[model samples]
Target: MLSIQNLHKTYGAQVLFDGASLQMTPGERLGLVGRNGHGKSTLFRLVLGEEDADSGIISLPRNYRIGHLAQHLHFTQPTVLEEACLGLPEGEEWDHYKAERILFGLGFVEEDMAKAPSTFSGGFQIRLNLAKVLVSNPNLLLLDEPTNYLDILSIRWITKFLRAWKNELIIISHDWEFMDSVTTHTAAIHRHKIIKLSGGTEKLYAQIAQDEEIHEKTRVNEEKKRKQVEVFISRFRAKASKASSVQSRVKQLEKMGEKEKLSRIANLDFAFHYAPIPAKRLMEVHNLSFHFDPHKPLIHNFNFTIHAGDRIAVIGKNGYGKSTLLNLMAGELNPLHGTVRSHPDLELGYFGQTNIDRLHKGQTVEQEIASANGALNRTAVRTLCGIMMFSGDNAEKKVGVLSGGERSRVLLGKILAAPANLLFLDEPTNHLDMQSIESLVEAIEDFEGAVVIVTHSEMILRAVATRLVLFQHGNAEVFNGGYDYFLEKVGWEEEGKQHR
Candidate 1:
């Protein structure tokens, strides 16, 4: 069990939290949700004693075991197994058993245990980090974005593992479905305050919204009553016989008035226009095969056809060829064997997860859009930027000084400003807030073009995907359904059974 009381933290001028409090008991699973850069991570740091809070008290039971997943990790070992073993406590028997169990759960085979972790891709390294944490088997676990780079199968594994776990857990993740499946309680951070909810994230959010609606209605009713009483007093106060009663009614009205200035919910509206239809066939792939190493083909015998106005979603686990497939479609890579053909007049707009580093350091947001070959006039560009929540002086600030979300918005703005009939997006919702993501969903829905998106976000898939393509074992299999249908056909319930 652990408790955080009267917690307060601030960064320079910005107050992250004030008087925030929370209590956790054994076997409790809590999901922490908030917009990006709102101190969710900072709260974890405060709990772990990795950072000092401005003022607060964090208390845990004596001898309580704690485990946390580090955002950035450095492994000095030569192999994945070695890195995972490093987290094991001393004693040969316990270390060997835990190491083996963790490696197996994380999808590593006996042969892979000997392979250098550095040789693996970043996603694999993240898996290694998770394996390390699992091997420790602490009583309290703090996971931040644990599903970010995991493939569907691995994510399923994690969800199962957590559901079976008896220890207390506080997880922070952007994946809505994952949170709903694993967590029993919700903690939301809003406007420098923390709200604790008794139900899961989705239910809690719904209840909060409902409560706000009820509160607004009550406030309105109270205001109406006050206005009626005021009118009565104004009309009857001049009469000698009714003066005392009118004055008494006015005093009661003043005492019973409601506070009407509750904060309004933030909402965004977005629309996008696509150019006239170009060609029937937007892109074609023939016998496409690629491999980082000769022995292991990431994608092989992949062939597909994309047409105008088609919204295709690529689904797969980590290391499976989702990004590679998008890159091939974008003409960023040559297939090791086979031809990728694009129709003439098929202009493309590509957004990748790693595009944060692609922005020019010296260019301001406005300057970056202006330099894009006159595709958009100043007003149109500014309006697009504003829809992304960048306005006034923020648009004039240098891109280098912008936060991660701001940079993402700038990049997205530039991409939207371009004229393209086909768009290839890789995890485009990574750094976006919920509001911005909804705005993007609206824009994409209105665009008259073909879209190929690779993401693990269930919400994004539900909003945009019309066709599902599953990537497994170096092959692509097409399924004729939307996101929900794909989940049903894939036997998500059966996968949940595997967890038990």
Candidate 2:
């Protein structure tokens, strides 16, 4: 068992947690959730003794084995198989077999096992890191954003493995569906405190939404009463007969208007505005195939069409050419075999991982949006900025100081500000908060244009995708129905049913 009591932690003037406490028992899995800089990782550091809390006590049994997945991978071992086996006892056949099994489960083949960790892509490197951690067989695991670089298949495999493992875990993942799958408890950091609840993330978020609604209603009613009392006091205070009544009303007004700490939840407000131009056929791919090597192809004989109002989701395991397909259609990548044709009038708004880095650091949010399109007027630019959570003076802040989530919003704002009829978005919700994700879902639902998105986030796929493109071993198939139908067809009916 692990227990944190009367925790108080702060970084300079920023108070992250004050008097926060939590308890986790053996075999319990807890999901830790919060905004980007809200101390989720800090809490992990505190628990691991990498940092010290100003005032607190974290108690655990002696010799409690803990395994933490490192944020970055730097393996000195000669091969992937050797690195994964480093923690296992030497000369033990069972340990060697377990390590091999973990590596294979995470998509490492026999050939990959002999390759250096640097030979893998960033996503595969993350898998290697996870495999290294899992092979250690710790009693408690601290995984931060475990699903960040993983695709659907690897994510499902990891989820299944964690569900059946009898160990304590504290995970931080933005993917709500993944969190709901393995967590036995949910913990959220809000208003400088942690709220721990039994059950999964879905129920916890639902309760938070309901509580916010009730708080808003209560605040509105109090404001109305306070305004009425103030009005009565001002009108009747001058009259001699009503002086006493006015004094009483003044006291009532003071009581009603007394400052109370309102709920600090700030919701994201945004919308996508697209030109009402329609094209029957926006893009077409015919016999498309791409390969780095002449004899082997990552994508082979792929064919698909994009029309206005088509919301297609591209999903598969890591390095399986989901993003390659999007780039091919967007003309970022040239196909070796077939051709991709697009409408002459089609304007593309593409948002990928690198788009955030492409933003100008010297420019403000308003300047960034306005510079993206010369035709955008001051009001239009400000409107776009406001939608991206840069309100009033906030629109003038330099982009260089913005956080990852803030930069993502700015990049999205720039994309939406354009008059593109087709959007190619890769991992649109990667660093966004729940409120921002909700706004994005609404924006996509209301968009009149088409979208080709490559994302691992089940929430976005379920909310925005109307068509599905499932990628497998060097092949692709398009499902005519929605995300649920695709999930059912792909042997995820039970998982999909639980989330639904």
Candidate 3:
């Protein structure tokens, strides 16, 4: 077993862990979940010896091999295959096929394996690192957001691969479905305490919520008893005949200690503001085609129509033009050979993955959301800001100084401020936490408008996709069914290959 005992860590005023202890049983694939800044990554660093805890014991067996995916970019070999094989043990160095399987499952092709690692993009380099970690036969595998750079196909393949893990594993991901699919146990970091539970993440979170509720109820009952004692003492204080009784009551009230109230944790909880339209046809794509290279078009002769209350999910590999399809329909990219027409009364709210970068550097969170102030009054704007987790002074923080996740929230705030009949969201769940993603999913499902979302998460797709725009085998086609139908009748093209 891996034991962490009496762990206590603090950074200035922020308490990350306090006397927290947890144990990992053998063969347990634990999914670690916590809100942002709750030290999910910090715990990984502590186990890896990359960071020191303030004071604690993280006891692992001596000579235990711990494997983790590297973010560093340093290549020592000429070919991608050679660099990945460096992770193999001394006698297993000849097991190149294992490395090949992992690399292929992670989206690497046979032709690409011969090329230098430096020749690939940053995302591909990260995948190469992931392949190395997977190839290494370690006692414990610690993966943090392994699906971040992967496509839907690769994510699917990895879920299968991880299910076959024989040893212990710990993974951190915002996609609960992905985590829950592979994990045998769930552990969470709540209120600077480690909570480990069997089964999926939902069980752990539900337990935590129940515990907090019980704590609050107990506190309330204790307060009521204390108040009753005080009243009795006040009513008999000046009466000499009841002097001893009042003194005893005062002592009883003193012994009834107060229960500390749990601090409020801000969560992303806001619905999208919908501007309903009477028109049934919101958008039309007539033979749309777009290409940066005339000889090799990314999108060619694609056709789809958008109707009110339609939930269209665009899905494909990384460079397969899923985002391009959204951009073409959204007027961010002009079609080369066709047209995309929208109803004039349609109110469009776009939350692109890259659009967060377009947020004005000098503008505060309040200013950015307030830019769409025509739809919301001053008090509503403040309330919206608070719901986006930017209460009071945080709303005034400049966009230039905010992190990627914070900027994503600001964009959501802006979307909430604007009343729109149509929404075009491209990977909006990238930097959000698990709870935040659930809230966004609820908001999307509740909106009375057409939603065109570009996503790789099957969880979101299964929950909301009424129709699908598929990029399969280098062709874009419309599948007039739900995601489950696509999985049952026609699956991803990559699933046909035997990478295992």
Per-model root-mean-square deviation over C-alphas: 3.9, 4.6, 1.9
Which residues of candidate 2, in runs, are more than 4 Å off?
Answer: 89-94, 209-259, 392-394, 487-500
- Give per-residue CA lDDT, model 3, range 353-472, as digits (tens): 767878999998888889976767778888888999989998889999987778999998888887899999999998888999999999999998999999999999999999999998
For model 1, residues 1-500, the per-residue Cα lDDT tens digits are 88988888998997888888889877889999887877998998888889998888889999888888875769898877778888785465346767866676666668988899888777778788888887777888999888776766667677888988788899988776678788888888875778877777767778767877898898888888989898999899889999899989988987995766577544445554465655899889988889888876777877789988999999876666788888877877888898889887878878886566778989989888666548678898888667666778777889989887788777777776777788888887776665567678887888889888888777678888999778764567777779888777674433555468
Instruction: Report the CA-based lDDT of candidate 3 relative to the real structure.
Output: 0.90
All candidates: TM-score: 0.85, 0.86, 0.96
Per-residue alpha-carbon lDDT of model 2 for 1-500, expressed as tens digits?
88999899998998999999898877899999887788999999998999999998998899888889987778888998888887664455356778888887777777987898888888888888888788777888899988877777668779899898788999998787788788899999977778888998768878887877787788888878888888898888789999999999877776665435465555677666676665799899999999777665678888899989999999877666787787788888899889999888888888887677889999998898887789889998998887787889999999999988898988888887887788888888888866577777787888888988888787777888888888764578788888878756674432444468
lDDT of 1: 0.79
Give the TM-score ranking, best first: 3, 2, 1
lDDT (CA) per prediction? 0.79, 0.82, 0.90
Instruction: Point out the worst 10-residue segment of candidate 1 by lDDT.
Output: 264-273
Clash pairs detected, candidate 1: 151-317, 151-318
Question: What's the C-alpha lDDT at position 463 in model 3?
Answer: 97
How far out, in Å, is residue 60 in model 1? Answer: 1.9
Q: Which of 1 and 3 is the better model by TM-score?
A: 3
